[model samples]
Target: MGKIIIYEHANFRGVSREITSDISNLGRLDFNDIISSVKVIGQPWVAYEHINYSGRLMVLEEGEHNYVGRSMNDTISSLQMITEDLHNPQITLYEHPNYQGKSRVIREATNLAAGFDNDIMSSHKVQRGAWLLCEHSDGSGIQYIAREKDNLPHYSAIYLNDKLSFLRPLRPGQQLCPGGIALSSPQPCSWHPGCHPAPRGRNSNSRSPAEMGRIILYEHTNFQGLSKEFTSDIANLRDADWNDLASSAKVIGQPWVLYEHSNYGGRFLVLEEGDHSFFGTKLNNKISSLQMITEDLSNPEITLYEHANYQGKSRVVREATNLAAGHDNDIMTSHKVQRGVWLLCEHSDGSGIQYLARERENLPNYKAINFNDKLSFLRPLRAGRSY
Candidate 1:
């Protein structure tokens, strides 16, 4: 009896015990070589290396796929730990760079260059690169990217010579690249684009989240792509989402907002003025309902008043004959006068807000209008009707 060795990437499983016919032709074959040979052998089973979909590689295995040589499980661990469970454990070998530390998020070698190409040449932050099995599910995302240096993509990607290693949805018994080739960085299994690492970069800590143009919040945000900003739940998580995150922000999670921003430790003009969150954090200029608005109200500043129904400003100016009258009349009035009526109306009404008459006479002519209403209305003296 002799020992058996199985190089699945090739169609050879029991080379020693079953391969007494082909030793003369075979010399040396690496993982890539093995996978390529299987494709040429025209066998029932084969290995695929090129990426299939957006970026995935597939590995296939048949029944009792490989019952040959004694295989080692942990290639990185020098212990040469072997697992012969015979259960036919499915294993995909990994090839990564030497360095096992954090590296700059942005690089030409990164896969993001395809769609996540912000194209930043260099920065101050310090980081490194390497490869890993991405084994533990807990090790999902690119973690703790320095203060501002976190927003980046972290999927089953590898960057080499500025090229991204796209996969074809790997499967069982598939051949894997030699070293650890990564899209970039050491991210938590949760790391993704536009999610937790949206704003993080090499110059992270020194800059503000606003400066980074994005924000990544929470332990792991489940997303992909580089949006304008980054924040937790910015995309409004919904059903039907993508499984991985990387170079480009994906709408798989829902709403597909790809980017977001938080108040950071201070206040900013996100939605509007006065509207603020804890720590005086204000909304930026997202401008939807006036509710999210918290703007800087300067003294005697021109501000826009909004109604639950209306969009733009909800108020205007009007004048009265008495000159120093209070609010304007809540009447559908024209820009003219009947009896000593000029400069009327200075406030708003329920139906419509006041507007400057453009006619210039100041006094307005009452048209379609009633008195008090829900939103409340201030009526000035009528043409002939007193007060």
Candidate 2:
């Protein structure tokens, strides 16, 4: 459960109201367009600009918000607690209304690529968690909040048709249940010792959960030609007679990194859990090693270098930060991942072209990936505890 306290005046002054559940219309309580500040507790909540949870939206993570910001100040008309498990958000975007035409599934926060950007999305289906769709690559401009839905046939009804450019899951506050488990209802039995049932004989028809971190590499694009499946790290693909042979891949459960050289050296690319039809020009048939990320990601650390090959000034980061606010903006040409996985972004708000960096990796050159001197924001990926 979650709680939200709304204030009628800035800085917690004036009248206030405490909300513990969804309110479709603030007018009923005579609180419409009067809230100036807010404080959230236990979980995340969303404030909407219109009644019935419609119009523009703002996500309120657990913390005190002295002011509701310019866009949402004194304009909130509705509120709803976010009760979904945001650890592995997923959504599908349709190119045409009524769930027609081309579609793409996304499981991570992303700045839409060339073909997917520029007012191309017309409908969507949220398979897991809530998502924020924005009009700019940096997550600014007009926005729409989308929650889990079997089908949202028309974006035009909301005046957002073919107008989305960036999207991301709503991150919850860093509150863990006992033993570091994320609070999801109906907890898995594996998380509680002595609750497991007796082991049963293996069944070929049984499917393994995505958390198993399985990946399949293909020798050709679109999963054609020779292929191999991996469930663990491969220091050198050459030893398996598959060096420089991966043109495409599919990931299940956790994310994986593909390195350009043996022993996990050189440039790398992070692939999230999904089907990858192509590995792009720079990485196609160039993967020499792979690393499966299976460690805790709650605490991530990375060091950015001003110059390539780990030279020049450097900055050590342990949490999400905007480099522009410091002296490291647009100057990081190399980086070393000390722990957990991190997302490097080109904008101050964790948007724009993004790159995934994994733990125990020393990437000495950003030029090879065409991202030299362009980093502005970064944050660790919070995938929750493995069950």
Candidate 3:
């Protein structure tokens, strides 16, 4: 152990160096000598506030306490001024060529023995064989964390252990060995407020959403309840198909409005639900288009929900009726993106032809009902129609 000397220069810049007691130059210069004539390299300069080091032997020169880090070339000696080189040669982990899905490499599977980008929390540094977490740029969020080989470090996977055990580990061959947490004289994470414990297992609510597993959206062949991107498989669906779909996606299926998702948002395929069957159109892309399809009463009531993205100039359309039990019809609502507009729920064919609200008064010809509980029936906002 020797003095961790901070030698300041004429430029007001300072550098730190470690000199052994065996070094003759340091023994020759006492506290009063100018200590900058010696040479050192690397990023040795830092502002005083940034240095975590404290309290060493002090000696003054020229009737003043020397600001020991600047402009002098002399050296001071100490046995207790000790520091550890926490940095081991780090091996960055990269993505494997065989990787699939939208997974992106957040860190290489290499050793980051030098520790985290934030050194202050070095105790939680990604260990030599620890898992590395990576998030994708899409709003869809994380793709997944991949693991590296034994002691491979940086480019490792995150699912190596159960999430009950955290993935981030430390570099190998350190004072602390594998398994069990370490004992440090200094407290790293003090008992601080707002530090919520992370969730674990299928039941534990302690897990943070960022740490959750990635869900890849596979294309749904039968895009009955899904959006346009999930479009494709619905073929023999007559009227009975609606009931089956309603049960699977968990929505009431009476007066439903079908909609193919617009070109935005990765082009999803979807269907919206409604409570009224006829309020406006004979057949249009708005909810007002649902006309009478049934002749009998005393049947189960139906409702429809619609999905909307966060964009666009928000406005009320012909089918725009805010009803209940239709939230999943719109993931936009689930993600908190409905503040600015009136979103309509629709069906799978990109058609907004109807919703299940008012059953037709005149069943034979299939006409919409008068909403506002009024006598005036509003028509769908079609190319050239006025209700």
Models ranked on TM-score? 2, 1, 3
Q: lDDT per residue, candidate 1, 191-287, as tens digits? A: 3332221224585336443331223212122322222233233222111111122222211111112212222222111221111122111122221
Give lDDT: candidate 3, residue 245: 19
Candidate 2 at residue 61, lDDT? 86
Candidate 2 on 1-387: residue-level lDDT in tens? 567899999999999999978999999989999999998876789899999988788888888999988888889999999888777889999999998998888776655632324578899999998898888755777887788764789998767788887777877664444433334434544565533333446885356565467799987899986567888999888655577778899887777889999898887777877889999998887898998878667678999999999999988999889888987789999999999889888899765677778789899999876789999999886553243
Runs of candidate 2 with Cα error greater than 4 angstroms are: 113-118, 173-387
Error of 2 at 106 (Å): 0.9
- Check candidate 2 and list the clashing pairs: 119-162, 210-253
Worst 10 residues of 2 by lDDT: 177-186
RMSD of candidate 2 to the true fold?
A: 17.2
Between candidates 1 and 3, the one scoring higher on lDDT is 3
TM-score of candidate 2 on Cα atoms, chains taken together:
0.46
What does candidate 3 score in Cα RMSD to the true structure?
24.0
Best candidate according to lDDT: 2
For all candidates in order, the CA lDDT equals 0.23, 0.81, 0.24
